[model samples]
Target: MVLPPPSHSRPSGALARRAVLLGTAAWCVGATGCSGGAKSPAAGIAPAASAPRTPSAASSSASASPSAPGTPSASGPAASAGPGGALPRARPWQPGPGEIQPEVKVAAVRLVEALGTWSRGQGTDRAAADRAAALGIPEALAAQLAVRAGSLRPHADAAVVRVIDAQYGGILSDTASVLVVCDQPTLAGAAVRPGGTTVDVRLSRTSDGWEVTALHPAAPGPAEALGPMAREVLAQSRIELPPASVADIRSGAVHDSVLRAMLQLAGSHRMSISVVRSGHPLDVFGTDHPSDHPLGRAFDVWRIDGHAVVDPASSRTLISAFMRAAAAAGSYNVGGPIQLTGGATANQFFSDDTHHDHVHVGFTA
Candidate 1:
């Protein structure tokens, strides 16, 4: 069974420099980055019939279950204003090849396009501003964003969520709507702001193209960012993988990919993996390690062709060669066999001798 790591083990700390603004740049599938894997060894979660609901409720659910469960919050920044009450509607950009993320690519492009349009309409007509509110805009958020626009400072980076809602009945001719939700900072000069508004966007299909009809802050805010991550993982059958390692044999995204390629290079090698708990290295668990194994960002590969590849001291050298091949192919943080008890090389990081019979390639994010 795959027992998730302690929830407290991972928390979103202040994001790193590159992680900020670079968007999906850090979303690569390697060990030395954010580690994640599938829940069950076979496949991950089933797809929901409908997308999850919006925030307000999501926050409550997350707080109730502190366990590392539920979907990722789809929260992110929307358009902001400049010093003189103007929104920062920057143009959207496209993703490059080999970018592992699909949703991030789509959402980022959409958000940028939405904001850029907003920027062009400053003053000429609050038409863009009005459309912003109509599209489920947050009211109090306007003021908060105004502050961010006036004097932007570097505090902890926040997030932006994208929400899509279908509106029928009551409104004009019944239609479907999509809105980008932005949560502005709550504090200003050491004081609390109340009653933030959620922005709503009304889109219309016109002769020119789809255009924003109105923008308004709805009562309930937009949904969190979790669902999108959940959706992505569900489709891919993988979880986010981080980067951390053991000895010479490291296993993360790059390493795992390398191992697969190495197997291919070595003429059709079949593989099996077991998730033995602590002190049970030689023991095998499941049949196949899912492509996106959730055993942290790292993985342990043993029992090639039903035999163990033990002896960390001597085996480390051979594994080192494997690591080189894997690294050249873009693997990261690939470590080798865990040193257990018995010989001079035993029990270095591991406590028992079971691993003496198999190889542990722990990949990083």
Candidate 2:
């Protein structure tokens, strides 16, 4: 569904003041260590962010296995290795407690990691089935995944996938959809190039736990002439997006309201968008109401000015400022880690454990 462009209206004085208050609150919370503390993962490096130390019920349900021969475990000897030795294995990605149906999310992430990651010189042909077998996935499902994996072009000799974040696209008692946001750095000859994609993983609940049923990689749609505003956003250097999001904009599926807000925010900070429309939940997680995202009226930002919104070390002031600026840019609904007190209307500003890692800007029109 396409939405019409919105008017370019200036923010009210009250909203501007609210932005300041939000920033101040973030600063105080950061200084006092009131927020949960965790280190940000180093960018463009092998073995992305470390998984949370505390294990959830889901982690116990879906365990990790070697992606290929010679792969090391997280607790293996690489930890005590000398300068010329093997590096520590990348920790498996896990869902936080706040995530809805943590076990379901884990199942989806594991399958992606199995499919996307492999050892050097490992033949890509049978890797998907082999890795899926290692994870105890059923034979029929394994074959299906193999067909899907066969189409992926191997860009490098070796690859490691690091999940940026996993969010619920939709959830129900017997089914769920997980959007796994990740990036892969591939080793080719002596160089590493950055790459990744967002996947819409479908799952079904079983007596044991949630099991993956299918995988839907983002298809940004056909390339075509876009509106001037869309073209401008696509060319903006400060605004980073995944391939699918780039396609979403190019497809002209996203609303002008979202694009305008993005441009306004880019004027002040560099932002990395995780989802625009193609990879998001069609409905609010576990709800019947349609989400602004699938309607092309919303966008999710994972990073602002180089600091990850999920990182404890990231500046609260920056995130808060960005969130407020989004509202001022014409967003009727803005959500992030910080829950601001005053808003032009009820439910205009909100916070939830699920949103602790990114800011959501939503438009009505």
Candidate 3:
């Protein structure tokens, strides 16, 4: 089943613009609030869990394995000479003209930015709610967001969030799901720690636009001994994943075919995965055909060898090579930004706007 085209552009500075809009705009009104089918932001809330730690420099060598699942890595930015050393500021995310349902994705991204970011001396208790309310989100939703934000332990006086990718988990006429992948660098007195999370954001459609309804933060699933192959993939320094995807791997739901292919592809390039099984559409975006992702037989990679697949500046050669490699690793269906010819089958390789930002690899087995 074919979905829409990939339509994200490089982000620009828009924090000031957002602040102004948030000050004047209003999305919540009347007794109806935003939408009827909206799920409560507090429902199905997962425990606040930290992402799998980035491997330290010493363990990140091409030949070395990644640090264990929860191992702590180095801190974030070095403090500046000023009071708290200027902490990084998140540039508000905006969708490009080609994005599918741009407003929906924007609503999801903005909500996450509000929940994860804060200024110096701001108490975590109310900071998320206050920022969300300023963005025109309803009071009830903002308060729920505050409760979710309270579970986080930033260990810093200030924090900033940088969204790496925002992808549609599912999109329908009345509701939608967005997977918001981000990196947060926090600033303490002078010490900064690198942190981030992936959230499954739920939204419902309204005349104004899409209104955020719920937030599902990823949780590190209960510890269980994993197969050798699965354990190795989790420890591989070259393979990166969001917290939710990490949990998927740990949950023992992913098929072996997917894990093997990931290891096979990692042999050549460093990759960043955006979604696995847990935070994806059960069916293909627009069709009833079941998506390989929900079956644990597929995965999406957004960054290859450190180059974002969406960026026009990333080399075509690299992305193309990665796609081909997926086929070589036993993927029956391979989709990416570039449409390559000479695959084993006529439809083996595909290029579409919806897949413009990442490479999708699906296995039948």
Deviation in Å, model 1, residue 88 alpha carbon: 16
lDDT of candidate 3 at residue 240, scale 0 to 100: 82
Model 3, position 149: C-alpha lDDT score: 49
lDDT of 1 by residue, 26-124 (tens): 212100011111111111111111111111211111111111111122333344433333322222222222222222333322422232232222311
Rank list by lDDT: 3, 2, 1
Model 2, 1-365: lDDT tens per residue?
A: 21111111111111111001112222122110001001111111121111111100011101223331111223421112222322223345654433445666667777776766666655364665667656666566665665554212234566555555666554445555566765554555655555555676666555555556666555444557889999898788888776556767777788999999999999999887877876555545433345687667888886788666766667889888888898899987777778776777766777764466678888887
- Name the regions of candidate 3 deviating beyond 4 angstroms: 1-104, 118-127, 145-160, 170-176, 184-195, 203-207, 286-290, 340-347
Question: In model 3, which residue pairs have backbone atoms overlapping below 3 Å?
Answer: 4-354, 5-353, 5-354, 6-353, 6-354, 76-192
* TM-score of each prediction: 0.20, 0.63, 0.65
The Cα error of candidate 2 at residue 172, in Å, is 8.5
Name the candidate, 1 or 3, with the larger TM-score value. 3
Better of 1 and 3 by lDDT: 3
Choose the strongest candidate by TM-score: 3
Candidate 2, which segments miss by more than 4 Å at Cα?
A: 1-107, 118-126, 148-165, 168-177, 183-196, 202-210
